[model samples]
Target: MHKSRTNFVFGEGDKNASLLLIGEAPGAQEDLEGRPFVGRSGKLLDKILKAIDRDRFNDTYICNILKCRPPENRNPSLSEIDECKPYLNHQIKLINPKLIVTLGLVAASTLLGKDSSLKDMRNNIFYYMNYPVLVTYHPAFLLRSPSFKRNAWEDFKRIRDYIKD
Candidate 1:
């Protein structure tokens, strides 16, 4: 199913790494660029990653739940997520990361098997497929709600702590 959608980005890191970042489907910019986190939200995400001392182009492997961009930047439907999930599962298995960081509600809800606000999701570590998973607010959400950034900073600090130790 994902084969026909050429816009999706997929892969593990180039070498041994223990952390994986999974996001929701691509946006228009990401679809066009063939990379995850390449637009405005991506810019903010880069800042956040830098704050935590992690870089997507180097230490972290990034991918989406769905490879293709949904029409009009809308949320991907249940069937889309269901169809593309196996690929994500496979990537996780291959990477064998010690930790998985799920960005935003849709990605976290799908991976963690629960529907909740980012507020409810952050600051705690969960488990998925036996790997430690951390949940955090999406950069887009922080763009909309700048007041929440301090909270996100705390969450990123937690991730750094885990990665460092």
Candidate 2:
């Protein structure tokens, strides 16, 4: 685990968090803060989670495919995710969460093992290693396109519904 990246931390809250959020990589704020989801996107994510009656800081196990932040927030290269996959896999095994939510294209692509548009990816739940995965637009995208908030909200509701079921 230590071999992965320096800016990595286990999710907050209970060690047995039921939800896991897998992201692409740490942003500048995440790298500097040594925490996942601390920047603008993180803030927006918090709101989404709150809307669904979940608290990211206390309910979801948040992580990235790559622990290290890519230069200038660039997308993580395939090799990087490959190198860091074991750590993520280990975390997933240890946490064994019931629901896994993937944020952004890179994380979703890595999890799904395919490249697809975010528009086509959302609106449905997929299975990976038997765990339910819900893919949604990254909060950064919502920041760029506020109109997508409705779609994001719909996804969040789906997550909430999954939890209920």
- Give a tens-digit lDDT track for model 2, residues 98-124: 899998888888898867898998887
Give one digit per residue, the lDDT tens place, for model 1 in 1-165: 444455656643433466788888887788777888888988998888888877776677878898888877789899999998888888888888778999889999999998778788787889998999999888888899999899889988888889888
lDDT values for all models: 0.82, 0.81
Ten-residue stretch with the least lDDT total in model 1: 8-17
Q: Report each candidate's C-alpha RMSD, comma-separated, in the order given.
A: 2.0, 2.4
Q: How many backbone clashes does candidate 1 have?
A: 1
- Candidate 2 scores a C-alpha RMSD against the true structure in Å of 2.4
